[model samples]
Target: MVEKKYDVTIVGAGPAGCSAAFFLAKNGFKVLLADKTTFPRDKICGDGISSAALNILKEMEVLKKIESIDHHKIGYVKISSPNGRMMTGRYPIVKNFRDYGYVVKRKEFDYVLFEHVKALPNVHVLENFRVENLVYNKDKVTGVAGSHGEEKIDVFSDYIIGADGVHSKIAKKIGLFNDKNKHRAFAVRGYFEDVQDLSDAVEIHYDSQVMPGYCWIFPTGKTSANVGVGVFNRFNETKEAKELFDLFVRNNKYAKKKLKNAKMKGPLKGFPLTLGSFGSKRSSGNVLLIGDAASFIDPLTGEGIYYALLSGKFAAEAIKKGEPNRLAGEYYEKMWAKKFKNREFMPGYLLQTLMGSRIAINAAVFIGSVSKKRATNMAGVISHVLPKYKMIF
Candidate 1:
């Protein structure tokens, strides 16, 4: 496209980027969606796709494409308290979306999303294009500067959408990075086969050692599953998340039983997660941040995909109704708040803050282990069918 100025430029071709590009181009706007890597690349994630995210894909006519790929359906969720008490419940339908969750590697899921957005004739996608700098003119973001192959490529656009993820260059460049350990989580994930009790249901374990974080076994099928553990970085400072994961799998009685004769299929990978919903400026000047770049991962569930899709579509709506050069940043924030942020934001933030301690987690486990209603209510919280405050012990 050369120096041809476009209506919108999106960095990072993940779900959020593709979602933004999807709407912008469908509306007949010239758009560019660029990523640092090519398709089928592995993205470290829980591999749990909630019904909320699936509904968005269905609305976009892309859910069927995702379903055609290798995946597993989740109808049950089992949560193990730190004291070894287990609670299992059914997934709840939220906002008309089915209760079933889907388990597919982010690598596979992202490929379908990227490919769908890449097909729009009006949307140009550049893989292996790493964004290194933001193009600025008089303190307003005009475009981006990056390298493709051995050559530098620069493009100008009226608006920039930062979907580049947690370590986003655009978010950092615009001074939106909030560096607080309490607001972040570090975790490791790996694939495993031959695990016992393999089912479509996803299981989460809360070991006393990994308080405020968790270990999960989300099945991808009847045989293989994504298994791993995460820990709140602040409380888990000296402990390697991988080592903790191993400790759980090797020592936790239930984990040991389930992992008996299990073989890890791949190397354990780690990723940083931004948690909680803080009242921060999501847009500044002509640039807006969505998805992980905006820190929308759920504090309780550690789910980001649903929020990413939510933010991307809401952002597109804001951009669609605004004047180009003078689009109001506050308008974008207000729109995001009304769509999904206002009702859910404060509660998520408060939950994260409260759960950061060891006492709350232990107490919840103690209470949840004895109360069937409490366990079911917690499942509702996970499904986002019930308010987060319901599970607060």
Candidate 2:
């Protein structure tokens, strides 16, 4: 057995973990980053990066690298109603900055981020390791016990950060995953190559019959795109995601034509999408949770990459400014509330109301058409921007 110590030990080298490691190591912390899987692991996602994520990447000096990669610039979002009515809106990423987001393969993106973290002098990356359990003493998490291949190892750290995905073992072990409200949706995603007639735009189709959730097509290039469907778990009792997705593809004329000769290049993967105000209590003793471990995904849209990065950075900042025990508890509670508390509540309420009635959707579109600014304000609410009541009404 080998024993080592670190100022902070992060489990799961996903976007959140890597972001945290970068900040922590850069700040002179002796950081240890470990992951069960190797680098360049594939993730099932729509591959759409939002402006918030772009800003964070720019701050980290990774935006230029991301732009150098093969990606498509998305300027507008076209949303379709269940009745075949369509509404289009532009989300300009603000002037003098990346005006729009990009769509890229997670394998490439995650690999780049992990590589950057590994380059940091104060960071040590242990690959091919699974954290089996946390070693706690007197109600404080002090270390983790795990195995790398056949060798057992113990890593002692002053603080532990759980950046693992939705099915977080740390959250479960600490009794945070037992909450009922934390369960959001079941999602299936994949990519298609040789797609045709694609533009620098993302399409979101909201058809109750085809998908209770939304079906998205994010263009990655001229002839390829990332296509996926997310179905709320409550809607899955009577529907299968794959069947609905296939039906959606057959029904949508554009989707049918573009994917006519396209082939699925990867295996379809399914994962749980945590929505709204769910997850275990984020801060407890010496352990902190970030990203999907805290259930930060938007209930309506199923977008989480931005929040994941935000939470990861917040966790690191908290650890840097405060002592281990105090920081772990304070960071989890304050950051969780400041960044995500309002975001979690409003979306679920708005989505439940909108999706429950066709009349409301029509009314919303009517209001949007009559007043673009107001509509934009209404849209901002779902986008986590607080809007005046007059704008939405």
Candidate 3:
């Protein structure tokens, strides 16, 4: 048995955990980043990165490394309705700047980020370690006990960060997993090869019949793309996701035509899409939750990578500046409220409304059709900041 102490012990080496380690280690804090899996592990994701996320990547200096791998410069977004209405918005790349977003393989992206963080002097990476329990003193967390291979290790840290994705053991152990307002969606996604007629724009098809959530086709290059559909799990309790996916691909015009002759290159996998924040009571004692452990995924689009990165940074910043007694919990709560609380709640509210009425969906589609700029603005409002819209007509 080996015992170690760190300023921060982060569970999960996904985007959020790695980003937190990167920022904290750069600031001279000792960080231990642990994950159950090794590098280049596949993650189930939409593989789309937004402009806001790109800015964070640039700041972290992993943008060049990402570019060296297999990626595609996404120039625009195509939103399609079931009734054949479509709208396209272009995100142009500025001079001396990379494009707004890129489609990347999570294996490569996570590996690059982990490598960068592991190179830091004050950081130690423990791979293939499963965190079994959190050692607590009364209500305050003091450390985590787990095993690396056949050896047992207990790591004591000033703070613990849980970035371990949707099924976070840390979150479950501390009684932070709540399903009160939690809307769970099941998504089946995979990569494909030899896909033709795919545009540079990421295409999203909204058809209520085949899939309640959106069907997305994101291009990674000329001959390959990431294609998938996300559906409300409650709707598929008795149904098979594969059957639904096949029916969707066979019947939908866009899916049928686009993936007509494409070959599925990888295994189709499913994962839980968590919606909304972890409430105001997510933090307890010295244990703080970030990323999926904190339920930071967007309810509407199911995009979480950006929120994950943002929350990770905020958590690391809190640990770096805040005092252990009074500031740890306060700092965690304040930072989450200031940065992500609104963004998480807005989409949940809007999705609830949209899910309740077809008229509302029609109205949304109508508004988007009337003005792409306004719709984009509306998306920005719900996803980033809420804006006041006064009807002129």
lDDT of each: 0.82, 0.75, 0.75
Cα lDDT of candidate 3 equals: 0.75
lDDT of 3 by residue, 1-393 (tens): 788999899999998998889888888889999999989799988788876777778878888888888888776677676665666655533444444578887888888888988888988999999999998777778899998999998999988998888888888888887554345677888888888788777887776555455678889888888888877654445556566677767787877788889999978887877766535466777788888888887766678887888888888788777864547677878888866666455645456546434455556667777886655554443223332131111
Output the better candidate (1/2) by lDDT. 1
Order candidates by TM-score, high to low: 1, 2, 3
Q: Which stretches of candidate 1 lie over 4 Å from their true place?
A: 339-342, 353-359, 362-373
- Pitting candidate 2 against candidate 3, the one with the higher TM-score is 2
Per-residue accuracy of model 1 over 106-161 as CA lDDT, tens digit each: 99999999999898888999899999999988877789999998989888998899
lDDT of 2 by residue, 1-393 (tens): 899999999999988898889888878999999998988788878888776687788766778888888878876666666666666555533344454667877888888888888998999999999988999888878898899999999999998888888888888777776345435777777788999888877887776566456788889888888887777766555677888788777777667888999888878777777765733468666677788877777666687887788888888888877764465567667777866775454645466546546666666566665666654554444333333242345
Best by TM-score, which number?
A: 1
Q: Counting only residues 3 or more apart in sequence or on different chains, how many pairs clash (N, Cα, C under 3 Å) in candidate 3?
A: 0
Q: Using lDDT as the measure, which candidate wins?
A: 1
Better of 1 and 2 by TM-score: 1
lDDT of 2 at 125: 97
Task: Give the worst 10-residue stretch by lDDT in candidate 3.
Answer: 384-393
> In model 3, what lDDT does residue 90 have?
55
- List where candidate 2 sits over 4 angstroms from the true fold: 93-98, 178-182, 278-280, 366-393
RMSD of each: 2.1, 2.6, 3.0
Residue 16 in model 1: lDDT: 91
